[model samples]
Target: MRAALFQMTSGVDPAVNAAAIVDAIGRAKAGGADMLFTPEMAGCLDRDRTRAAATLRSEADDPVLAAVRDAAAKAGLWVHIGSLPLKDERADGRWANRSFLIDDRGAIRARYDKIHLFDVDLASDESWRESSVYGPGEQVVAADTPWGRMGFSICYDMRFPDLYRALTNAGATILLAPAAFTVPTGQAHWHVLLRARAIEAGCFMIATAQVGLHEDGRTTYGHSLVVDPWGAVLLDMGDVGGLAFADLDMGQVADVRGRVPAITNRRDIPAQVTLA
Candidate 1:
């Protein structure tokens, strides 16, 4: 399976972000990517609560999603429309960080709302309270693709290893982690964390990211990456806006598991208590 990781620098305007994504999808198709995955926040990253709320659209009303569905059909490629902000009127008008999987026929096969909400205070004085303006999702989603079962996850979800573990155990050969990692954490832990996840799960990890400062003055650590099942870095781009394509040989999953069968060697024994 040939996959393309489309790294992007999405601005605050939904229209501009949509145009950028359409072009990237075309390029990925031209480069022979059977499937394409974009980074989190594919359309607009406005931090302002009022602005974000005002711009939110339902799945049926989202124009960006419409374009992506059409583009996937035109190129005859499976596409993962990274996390989009969907308007939710229940929480005094909030948004849901949602993702969509488009089949080759340009029809949405599955949708996943981001289950983990990022409500942390970063060291860069860059604090984000995603739950304050966005409602958290309860469902964990996986899509069946031509290649294999592809698990869906957004930015902050990468830090949680159990999610990936569950995915791989549930017959997922590839896990997609589309993120908008901030500068501080991305610089320190991004690559190592990604490689570790791939090694532990024995799965191909595709991580596309936002590469630079956004229109909201939020700087994202943009090192998009692809890691093999054996904890090897296949591709890593530092602050570049483009697609990273790699041939995912599903056959390697067997070899990697033979080498280090970590996933299957778990013991449910009680943990040793620390001397408090």
Candidate 2:
């Protein structure tokens, strides 16, 4: 299956980002791609919680999502809208970092809200409290498509191995880790972590990322990647913001799993506490 990954530098305006997404979808369709993947916060990236809260809209009212779904239906493209910041009704005023999988007919096939909220202090000046504004999702979501079974995850979730394992156990053949990683962490751990996930899960890994400086005064590490089940990099879209393609071979999953049965070679050990 041919997949198109869109690396974007989204700004504070949802309309502008929507335009970019629409154009990328057109390009992907024209190139005969079966699917397109985008990055986290694809709707809008804001500098502060206040501005983000004021700018974001609910899923039902988001123009960006509506436009993308319409384009997907018209172009007969299966689109994975990486993640969108939307107002969450369950948490009163808190928002949701939601990912969507739209079918070729413009219907939403699956929705995965980001479970891991990024709340870290890289430095005094470069700290984020994502959990402060966005309520975390409690479920892991995977869905079936014509290509194969796909596992869904957003930025910080890439750091968690258990989630990937669970998805693999649930029959995921391909994993998507769409992100808007900070420059410091992305430079330090992005490639290593993603490659590790692919090797461990024995599944194709696709990561479409946000790049360059944004209106939010944040610089993202942009290196959208596609890795085979054997942990080989198929395509690495360097620090540019655009579309990159890779043809996925589902047969590679069985080939790698047969050689290294790591997923099934596990022994459960009871937890114990010992005095240090």
Clashes of each: 0, 0
The residue pairs that clash in candidate 2, if any, are: none
lDDT comparing candidate 1 with the true structure = 0.84
TM-score result, candidate 1: 0.94
Candidate with maximal lDDT: 2
lDDT of 2 by residue, 40-76 (tens): 9999988677787777889999999999999999999
- TM of each candidate vs. truth: 0.94, 0.96
lDDT of each: 0.84, 0.93
- The candidate that wins on TM-score is 2
**Across residues 1-276, which tens digit of lDDT does each residue of candidate 1 receive?**
888888899987888888888888899899998988888999878787677767768878888898888888988888888778888434566677888899988999988888788889877687788888778777778878878888888888888987887787688878888899988999899998999889888988888899887888888888888898998888887897877787888888889998888878965556787788
TM-score of 2: 0.96
